[model samples]
Target: MTTLTGTERKNITPGLSVSIVLKKDQRSGKLTDGVVKDILTKAPNHTHGIKVRLQTGEIGRVKVIKTGIV
Candidate 1:
């Protein structure tokens, strides 16, 4: 909503480019840029960001919604 880090699953629509952190990279807080292809989080909301799959086939919780990012 107001903060990109706390973006809800409902707001993460398909085709929207975003930066995310994979489960393996969670400890490192690495950010992977990709386009939202599928929403995996079924809950109404999440504090750690919504989990989604990118068009590149990478899955993770969103950290940043990208602008002109692949």
Candidate 2:
């Protein structure tokens, strides 16, 4: 199996809500369903991959593969 290094990921500024699907699952292959909760900007990469506290208090990273959106 080949792992994706990454594509030309466009810069996603914080606060802009976006959605993406999980592209790979070690056991299930891939997950087609996903939703955008919040955009993270504190990371060094300045990428939108972070989990924010929701009303339900759930925490998870944005499962957005650059290719899955476009």
CA lDDT of every candidate: 0.82, 0.35
**Number of clashing pairs, model 2?**
0
What is candidate 2's lDDT per residue for 2-70, written digit by digit as tens?
222211124443333333323234245343323334443355442334433222333434444333343
Candidate whose TM-score is highest: 1
Q: Write the per-residue lDDT of candidate 1 for residues 11-51, one digit (tens) a residue.
A: 77899878899999999999998889999999878888899
The C-alpha RMSD of each candidate to the native structure, in angstroms, is 3.9, 7.7
Q: Clash number for every model?
A: 0, 0
Badly placed stretches (over 4 Å) of model 2 are: 1-41, 44-48, 65-70
